[model samples]
Target: MILFVSGCASTYSTRSVEPSGFLGDYSQMRAGAEEDVQLIYVNPQADFGRYRKIMMDPVSVYVTPDSYLRKVPKEQLSMLVNELDAAIKTQLTPHYEFVHEPQAGAMRLRIAITEAQGANVALDTVSTVVPVGLAISAARRAVFGTHSSIGKAGIEMEILDAETGQRLWAMVDERAGRKITGKFDKFSKWRTTHDASEYWADLVKERLESLQAEHAASTP
Candidate 1:
């Protein structure tokens, strides 16, 4: 039986994904600079250099188009969210102070896991949680720069001013796992999701630093 994974979300597809409506507004978003799988927007008037702390909300599951992710077990979803949270925190902790409440110089970040592809046949049979690893297939790498048989994940994120609740940045993106040459098919169903979350977290840091540099240059 063919189980539907993430409701037709595909890493190889050139067509853009439709919004999951988790961000509420998509009017300002445009294609991301580094990849085809991203749609992003930044508030030009927002001052990135002023923020030194961040309040990150727990990652959530928000499947769209009604019921696409129902086939995935609730525990699996929980694991996925936890993995994302860990990955993002690991990436951002060095650069920013994580806080629990809104405070001066703090930005609020919210993220949601909107979609994830189902596991391959082997993974489907396993009853317990699988160990996560990012090993990709050679054939898939040559064709799509993605892992074969392994699943992909999609997410939506937004950053806001902690004080005023004004949105500063937003992004929606999806990704598949990377290829590991020589080491093959040591796969985990959630590895791509974990990798994608880390990538997004790094992007957040990169974007903020760029804005900070620009802000510093323009300061009198």
Candidate 2:
């Protein structure tokens, strides 16, 4: 039992790009990034009623040993996307249109479930290095109501200029939900006891608003 609990207290880390000066590997990605842009329109959630999905599977890779990684099924992605879309739409509408490809015409916002992990990593160590600084994902069948939650809902959005194919802005967030343990037993789908999407959204919006203010401050 001690070993089992100790094993559960494991820790893992992973890193992903947060854009930068350019987007793609091609030469044009640099020059395309300098264009004067406008919001034109915004979709808090884009498709699938606001949440979009990519074919790439969600991966659980260990940043430590750096070898063990398993692909999460597309079904999980699909289910999570739908749940996230509904959650976001409850606050805001679809941010933009899906013109087929990113290079179709207007700016495209693609949301991919980059990462969705819910395993309990046992760690009494102070420096476990959580990528999102949050606990594991789990199911909690109560909070919002008495209904049972299937699993957690996580979403990551990348806004790219379709013409340039450059990712300008992006945000990754996860929310806690619950799955029915039995007939109605509920538990936190995440290791932590809070939905992180709201916090992340506010953080992103704060940065965006600050940048907007800076741009305005620098203008006239």
Candidate 3:
């Protein structure tokens, strides 16, 4: 079965940059379509799962759109961006053009997130009774078998014209809180995995790869 998934939002732990470095191949996502060429990067958001939800999880936080830098507690955002800048550069192709502003060139694209939180709740029976011997002495929080991810997050992207700012390609990446295991597909959500950093990285890699393939197919 064929599925359409879009990724836009990102919980960058680094400082924001101009996004100009990603110039090349930026047009392929909207190749053949007339107009100037520009690639815009959307700010990433963070979705949190509190309470019991945090107890069980896969990836803690998920970043959308992808960035060379991640915002952290105490660090220069630009510095962080530099660290991942190379990786991000290598990811984009050497053909497409990137523009910081929108114009008549290529169309525009937007990125967004959906349901970015989840949890695993193991509910127990809470009763109130004053029996002489052993009525309901006290309530105890027992660990039920095991509940996987019970929360979810999503993202979306849209491509528009550079000058007139017209709309073109659009995509939304979403995930339903589902239990995941091991590394390969490893992910972290909020407290479940401590900021879903690696998870977001993996998704970003996949997105870049997808863009590369599309660029090649559309290239003359």
Candidate 4:
């Protein structure tokens, strides 16, 4: 019975990436939506309609032994986190008021970048080692959603009640860049990470909207 239940549950750690222990716990996470790439969990008691503000914590990078991003230069890692923060803020700012201190109606958000891998290790290292980052082409961004070889990245995030410590929602997702090579082959190692951050931010906003809708529908 235990094995059967375990088989039915979604696995957070995968061959391409593993949980960096940044989330602290992964026991409640399960298959998210119909997508295999996402693992998520939401507290049943969470009422999204009650929150009108968000407290976004600084984005963090996992540097433990299991992290693929550990070897990345500090500057590159900082860039990744900053880009992710900007992406998320852009998505959420329109829907919720941004707050610094914990208040009555707010949710605190936290994110951790777990993996960032480029297609060629030598080239990847060189790109980061140098001061100037590689320039990514618009064509590469279009192809990034399809074939994957140029790069890949992963992230984990959680939302918690601002006043209380209870977790409201959490998610883990990963994405890979395309294999297409040509004039666009030489791209930034953080390109996929940037794309994934945008995707996650969009999803988080959509999920919050849906949660609010659900509460509204059930209220009346």
Give me the candidate number with maximum lDDT.
1
Q: Top TM-score: which candidate number? A: 1
Roughly what TM-score does model 4 have, to 2 decimal places?
0.76
Per-model TM-score, in order, reads: 0.77, 0.38, 0.34, 0.76
Task: Give the CA lDDT, 0 to 100, for residue 39 in model 2.
Answer: 13
Writing each residue's lDDT as its tens digit, candidate 1 over 1-220 gives 1111221222332224567888999999988754534688889999898999999988888877653466688998888888888877886899999999999999999999987774473642231123242222544456665555556678889999998999998988777644331223335556556556656666676777777888898899
RMSD of each: 8.4, 14.6, 16.6, 9.3
Q: Candidate 3 on 1-220: residue-level lDDT in tens?
A: 1212222122221111122222223443321111111123321220111101101111112243452112222233233233233333333324234444543334333333222343433211111112321122221111321222333333334444445444333333333322323222232323222223223334444544455455556557
Off by over 4 Å in 2: 1-75, 87-107, 119-156, 170-186, 190-194
Q: Write candidate 2's Cα lDDT for 143-205 as tens digits.
A: 232112223333445555565654545544333332212222223333321233333333333
Candidate 4 per-residue C-alpha lDDT over 157-195 given as tens digits, one digit per residue, 9 for 90 to 100: 999998896999887877665333222434555556666
| Candidate 4 Cα misplacement greater than 4 A, ranges | 1-17, 34-37, 121-148, 180-186
Model 4, residue 81: distance off in Å is 0.7
Q: Between candidates 2 and 3, which one is better according to TM-score?
A: 2
Off by over 4 Å in 1: 1-14, 34-37, 66-68, 121-148, 178-185
Candidate 2 differs from the real structure by a C-alpha RMSD in angstroms, to one decimal, of: 14.6
